[model samples]
Target chain A: MILTEMMMKVTPIKNGTVIDHISAGQALNVLKILGIYHTTDATISVLMNVTSRNLGKKDIVKVEMRELEVGEVNKIALIAPGATINIIRDYEVAEKYAVDMPDLIVGVMRCPNHNCISNTDEPIKSQFLVKNKNPVVLRCLYCEQTITENIADYLI
Target chain B: MFEKRHVLSMREFSREEIDAVLAMADTLEPYAYGGNCNSLTGKILALLFFEPSTRTRMSFETAMMRMGGKTLNLGPAEGSAIAKGESLADTIRVIGCYADALVIRHPKEGSAQLASEFSPVPVLNAGDGAGHHPTQTLLDLYTIRKESHLDELSITLLGDLKYGRTVHSLAYALALYGAEITLVSPPSLRMPDQIKADLEAKGTTVRETGDLNEVIEEIDVLYVTRIQRERFPDPREYQKVARSYKITTDLLKKVKDDLIIMHPLPRVDEIDPEVDGTKHAVYFRQSFYGVPVRMALLKMLIGGDDID
Candidate 1:
């Protein structure tokens, strides 16, 4: 297919991380997860609506000179659970694995509850439990308020 | 087991812990009845009520005072440093330094948890927006235990289940004791589907319906909550479901003879005046149980063995 052929033509990164198989149309959310708002010193490439063998359409994010952190991966897993993380070194894939969400998340994202202690003026850090991983159901440990529908909106 | 701990949600308590609280409440009943008891003498409690509450606030104060303990009350937090743009953290930190325990009621859902983070002492959730109310749940469980044992009884929760924090917490607590729950509300004000799934996951039988008359006969406890006019974004929607489910003495004809009716009071026009005189009306007594339950909670949290 034309889309698959074009996907193969993109240049490979020498030393960086490649987030592959992001559910189509979530590349911007992935960028937010990586904290890549403005132009950074490192090279960054984001491909949206790319054709995939498994998924009909997908998005990919490539960042040079930086590997993904567990907290970042956790945020990504909430939005794109099936996405794979590929670390590239010297123009070859060095490590490849799917993001594994942690059972408990601390201070990564703010609680969706506006009244949550985390959102208050207090020094309380947000804490969440992964109630479900596949669709990313997060329950606030303090308030017990569940966030399933808008996982992206609450992502820090 | 709950010594110097933060009571934030009903989810934090297990069946055994709930049983323990109820047992302690049973032990402290005499003090709740104005008997002389000094369980928490010299212990100081800080009452931080950021919201307006007559029952919860007074009950906590009474619980401490009856047990020979004192309170530092910050009436209507809007007047505190919070009004002058101080963060909830700063205010809690200041109070935490002064008191052995903090009782906070805020307009925000997670405010108690936030206060617990800053306070060095134990933090008790009075009510946080629409979030969990652990103390209220304790009183509710106590009421349930008193009216008609918590186990093996069918419960019908009437009216606005959508925004009723009491109903949400009560349902979760009741499930721990294997109570069959039936939720009755207008279609527009139904209980959230997520709560239904959570109850089912915990192995509780939950039935949802719009008609209360159809399920009234099978119910042993009818817990009614008012349909707040503010919950609706559009006032027109509120007008439609407002009068859909009011409890009257005439409606009690279809219910079981031993059925117990309860409400988290400051109720507005939901239960008819005639029903207040019926034997089923245990809501006032339920409100009375708050004193003993809270006294039990203070004892558990304050960490003293002897109740003088």
Candidate 2:
């Protein structure tokens, strides 16, 4: 069943982005990526743990009059690898595609290693090589520390 | 191909690049031994040692001098501007103006990578805290090639696998050549889970063990690293495993006659002095290879590309 037809709980956006198929329980993280808070001025609608035919359970975020940036897409891909990004124009789906988990992630997140050079006062950007995409395993390019869990905590 | 290139980590090198370095080292053997090559005549090399080092500092200084190049030696951090709280970037930028190439050894991991950015010249990482030591790994490769073949050798890396940057760098490099590695360290100092996983994914057979006697005979090359007193957050924890794995002459008798023993030295008690007389000890000879290997690297970095 479609989200709008079943819930009748939230309204759709006129022109903006709709992040769909986010893994269940990650809607808050998606909001974190979008930098949304209670004080956010943009009209935002969040559907948590909604029933989806594509995924067993998914989260959908609809933001009115707010377009998504490339960094936001990359952040979404890291937390929720299988999520799809939908661009809506005039309440119509204009463009849609799943975010690609890039092989080399530059400056999107900080390395978990406390001793990592990127963490130092030196002017060096944290770079990571995506070792695995499903669970979002990232390896630090400089220190070579692999981060598998608590990835959301390390978000930039 | 290393012309004006900064060697920050062994992870940055490919198998072909490693072979290129080994081949160049072989070509520069005469210059390393006693012959005067004088290839880097007009070039100036800088030695910026923020930490104390014996082998690495001397080898680089010797490598450049043998090639007829001059060296600007910046002694340890205490007497320098760094003691007065000068930043690494400022120090590197200042030294970059004085030399054609810079070799740095710092206590902080990733300082070499940071130095590479600030310097106009190529930056060579002599050693960087527990992060990486690319030059040591190169010399290890050179030694491995000299003693045994780089391919399909069962190598055991024992002791302090966690904080030993040499083991970390070597493990990655050896995996490139399809070496079957057996890592033996105490529970506290085991190989980092990520490195072991990455190596396993790369098709290198990795075995983790806490016992040295069980895996000793199976190893063709015994690569040992010292369990550093400083690496342990608690000194009492280091005491538990400090003398656990020692290489003695009696133990070497039980192993293969051709089994090669290697160490990144400044040995305390991990390797007994008695083993030095045995044919198994190749570490001193291994230490000597650093000069030629570094000479090859210096030539590649600073000198022109037309080498015969």
Candidate 3:
């Protein structure tokens, strides 16, 4: 059996973060904010609006030759809180990252409130509290409004 | 001296800060009822309104005057600097020079941000087009707390969420206090994306439905809003959905006996006049609070111990 580029098995990179379980539609949104969507020496694969068990249907992305920093990983966490990041070395799991809910996330997630503290170019980041369990929620500490799940992964 | 502040939206205040403002408003309410307070002594508030606003513009001016502050009213747009293509920035700069603070209402969105950039004084946003009326939110919050006795009550937001800037600002204020918000509008006039996500993410437990009958009884406060024809994309479409949801007295049968109905007025048929007779209607009293609540805001933003 032959596999196309979309269907082919993706080989993991050494010492880079592998972000998995994005809600298919938000993969590119995550990539744009993380700056991993385009690369010169790296390969970026994205599967969008795909079928999955966890999400009833979900999407996946495997980036080769690029390492993701905590700040960049936060971009994904803002939008897709359910997303999981796995650190790979020699195609072996080195560490795992389940979106860490920061007690006060500043300049990370864009406050769902447009008039939020972060919206003004006023050199201040939005702060939020991780208020719940099971499905973690980010509450804007300043405005006390909720940052949407779609915008959650970005709270760096 | 009263300093300048930009109050484009209610999102500027926190739950506690809002409460503080309300407390101050309670103090101002007495002054309004008895007579003028005139505590500001010798400050000035510049009223730069391109659009005609009866309540808000007058309220702020009155608030400042009662506090012993002077006001510069930019009466109408016909002869105002804006008629001659004088930019908002330029006008704000002009106003910022003489006044200690600015209270502005322009017909354009984001005009307040632009004004705040140039205005030397703190720019209190009166109402920037269909954008926001933060002072109104403060009063609305004050009214809800007084009548409902709970900030986190079951709130039903009816009518035009798309352009009802009051509702947009109020929703976030309510969300901060942990209110369960149900946005009821025709599909065409639903709440904006950022706000919807804001409510859901903050554990607001929001319900977005086109129909109001299903949830009218469950609500503690039925927040009615008028559909602004100016905010519509297609006039034909506006005609179809603008009046789709109306809160009549008969509809209150499903509501709690103590349910409070509110509207940031200049209302159309969205709320039947019959509803006004019932205790459920707080829109009038809510509208009345504009003077004192804004007085409290002007005092706080201008630097006063009255904030708490």
Best by TM-score: 1
Query: Which lDDT tens digits does candidate 2 get at residues A1-156?
Result: 567565587776789999989989888887876568558888888888888898889998888897887666866888888888889999899999898888887776788778777887765678888989887789887777788888778877
Among these predictions, the greatest DockQ belongs to: 1
lDDT per residue as tens, model 2, B99-194: 999999887777888899899999999888777889999999999999988878999999989878789889999999999999999898899897
* RMSD in Å for model 3: 9.0
Question: DockQ for the candidate 2 complex?
Answer: 0.47
Give Cα-based local distance difference scores for all models. Answer: 0.86, 0.86, 0.74
For every prediction, compared with the true complex, DockQ reads 0.54, 0.47, 0.04
For model 1 chain B, the run of ten residues with the poorest summed lDDT? B1-10
TM-scores computed on chain B for all candidates: 0.95, 0.93, 0.89
Where is model 2 more than 4 Å wrong at Cα? A1-10, A35-58, B1-4, B74-94, B151-154, B180-220, B228-244, B254-256, B304-308
Evaluate model 3 with DockQ and give the value: 0.04
Q: TM-score for each prediction?
A: 0.87, 0.84, 0.64
Those runs of model 3 whose alpha carbons end farther than 4 Å from true positions after fitting are A1-156, B1-4, B229-244, B304-308
Per TM-score, what order, best first? 1, 2, 3
lDDT of 3 by residue, A1-156 (tens): 787664465544665667888876888777775765455566777777776777876777777766676766764665677888877788787777776544555555666666543455543445667676336577765445664454534533
Q: Is candidate 2 or candidate 3 better by TM-score?
A: 2
Tens digits of per-residue lDDT for model 1 on B100-172? 8999888777778777777899899998887878898889899989888887989999998988888998999
